[model samples]
Target: MPGPKSNLIDLEILDGMPDGIALVRVDGSIIHMNAALRHMCGVPDEPGEPLKLESLAVPDNIAQWRRFFTHAAEDGGPMSFDATISRASDKFTFYAEVSFHRKSLHGEPVIVATIRNMSRHRKIEEALRLEESRLEALLRLNQMTGEPINRICDFALEEAVRLTGSRIGYLAFYDEEQEKLTMHAWSAQGVKECRISNRTIEYPIKNTGLWGEAVRQRRPVITNDYNAPSPYKKGLPPGHVRLERHMNVPIMDDGRIVVVAGVGNKPEPYDIRDVRELVLLMEGMWRLLQRKQSEDQLKMSLAEKEVLLKEIHHRVKNNLQIVSSLISLQSEVATPENMTAAFKESQDRIRSMAMIHERLYRARDLAKVDFGEYLRNLTSYLKSSYQPRTAEVQIDVQNIMLDIDRAIPCGLIVNELVSNAFKYAFPDGRRGTLEISMRKDENGILLVVADDGPGLPPGIDVSNTPTLGLQLVHALVGQLDGELALHREKGARFEIRFK
Candidate 1:
């Protein structure tokens, strides 16, 4: 039953308002429908239009609408609910928000409903959800730091396929200069279903077909119709996954394509948005690859340095054992005077070798030693060793540098020459000067050690000298592949020059 004549609503104002307006009675019957509501419900606002709103509900929702209207009438003040109404042409449907109020029109009260289609709004919400998932996928990929490159690429491919609504995907690493690529990662399911026997298919871009056009054109390529005839089409190899639709996006770094991210057989055609999403993921993957490579290189460099340090330790241990053997032999000297001198000489030699290793151990660069510093330490030690005689002996030396191989021999030579001068140069409480100087000359390095107190006996062959100190000086000079000269001017002096 419709509302009374006096209960009619003035719907002319609402007709132009872009919303569906309708008036109903308390018994689930229609009193009036404006043009918008009429067009929305597949009903005409004319003579013999259906009086009952239930007449417009589809068969499955008829009882649902019956209860909905009954409840709204009982509330009688204001109410709103979501609904789907069939279109006037019955071709499709529209989702809408239906609201109604109890209002007095003229004298009697009726229900007024306003219907606004929510189809577009629902679509916008869905689009936002899709974009959110895409961003979430990228974030998940980025958070996989320290993971292996292949594993990260696999995850990226999976997300690319999933977010782009595709059945399969692949990420291929590109050689930008060579225009070549090797398939590196495939969607786990995509690889399982493929029939191709050669998984190591490295394709040159020039020889590739539709899929390679992305690199060729340096842009994203979409093939909505994969089977269409085209000049760039290359027939698929046997066991290759069939493609109904496909898209490829090239990830560029420094203006060169470094990776090509491709997805195929999407149920729906791909678009620019898919290109953008794939580019984001692949670019992130490229950064991960770069980081992994740098980390690997650093690991390799550290490993090499570790090996070098181990070798240096081994050499030092061997040399220290040799010095230990020499000290053991010195313990066997027969006479007390000779034994004391022999032990002192052996100890000085040990100290000299030990000092070089100590410097190497403490040095920032293990490859070389500051020979100047080594000389100063040696002279100070020699002066301390021959104490009680005098603290008045003056030592002057030059600055020099040499690597471990040459520095060791030079150190031993300095130890012997400087010790001999301190022991025998000054006699009878005489205080004198010992001068040691080194310089780079045209021939090589010129090392001179001289003391003004005394000179060696004439006609003695210095090269074949029987004394251990002079023998060591001659041997060390030979080790350096150099010439040694004895000078008798003013006092005893030795000049050793080596390259």
Candidate 2:
């Protein structure tokens, strides 16, 4: 038991503490209270009578306080809890952290209670949680790349309404070419039950109301009281949802307002933080939309180029066919055997070049030709033109690819060498076999045209041969930057190697 002096010192210490301190009897009647406790309870400086602790508790919390006191006394242990307390005069409510303990005062048991206000700390925690949620929403928006613009806009609008605790949200895109704004996506929480039908809301942007003001100003617009009369006010359409608080942010691109985002009917007035969050979301969506548009344009450009290339190949092939036909006509009119043969050789060369373009027109990859298939087709044409009665042409070529630059010259070289073999090496229907082989190794391409018949005329110098065919072969070999060799042992063998 504390004596008079000890009790006075304890009262002084309790009064000096920051937390509200109160002493209550076992029945919950307040025996004594410090200045902090008196102020928290809204008690007058000079009370007419003692006040009960339960009186300071709001109606809903009175029973909870009674149960807490009973538990503290029976358990003989300190108890900590939280509750809302209200002042009786104005019914003002405040959250508090409270601790209770059974203690002996003047040989009688009493409950000592301490109260600490938690309103400020709770507000800070709530704000941090909200900021965290907004950051997560921003991250989700950034990850939606490559999606269609409409889908991205819808997601952004939905997230804006959800993050800002608004009932409805919409995103509109401006068509610069048409000089108009169109709503692309919208989300409404209660459209089914509301007076407004979502279908009726679709319309072009008009120069009226808050939305129009945002577009004209090209900045953010916020209104806490949308019902207030103003010069800019254009009354809402019939069956439209009533707007109490609203906000709109413009999405700018290339120094122009390309998109507008708006939200309305939030429980509380919109603040700068809400505007900032909505702007961030809209900006992210705009970037994604821009990227999707660029990808689509690139695809269209590539397709157009592909069509143009095919047309070019087709025209070139047709022109080369015309040149081949002219050569054929010239050969038919030539009287001299030598002049006719020269004209025929020129026709074969032109046809060989034309075949490359024909293959390119039909191929999926127009840049390179399937040289193996081209060689097979060329050999068939040469055999048909020369009419080799007894000699059979055999092809041993791998499936090799060459670009047009290399393929055209290579085709001419084959035409000249093979025609020479047919005319000179095997004469008077000489029965023999002609082998044509092409292969690619680490050393580069190797082409060999050989015949098993009488050898070349004795001492015929291939490097300085007078024959037009051999001279043409030499010139084409140099053009290909290739090494050429002539073998005249059994028949004629022409081999060329080029990188």
For residue 490, give model 1's deviation from the true position in Å.
52
Clashing pairs in 2: none
TM-score of 1: 0.53
TM-score leader: 2
RMSD of each: 13.2, 18.2
- lDDT for each residue of candidate 1 in 265-358, tens digit (9 for 90 to 100): 9887888878877887778778877877888777876785687688877777878776876666556553676776787788788888989989
What lDDT does the true structure give each of the candidates?
A: 0.78, 0.80
Please, what are the lDDT tens digits per residue for candidate 2 over residues 1-499?
1223237778888889888888877888777678887787677656666677778788999889888889988886988888888865577888888888999877888889888877788878877987888778777767777666677777888888987889998788776566577767768563542575445434455645667677778889999888887777778767766788889998889988898889998998999988988898888778877887788878876896687677776756765664666466556556676786667777788888889889976876767899999999999999889888888889999989997768877888888878877776678877999999999999999999999888778877878976656766787788789999988777888899999
Runs off by more than 4 Å, candidate 2: 1-8, 31-63, 85-95, 175-179, 197-206, 299-312, 315-499
Error of 2 at 96 (Å): 3.6
TM-score of each: 0.53, 0.56
Q: Give lDDT for model 2.
A: 0.80
Pairs with backbone N, CA or C atoms under 3 Å apart (clashes), candidate 1: 42-88
Candidate 2 has its poorest 10 consecutive residues by lDDT at 1-10
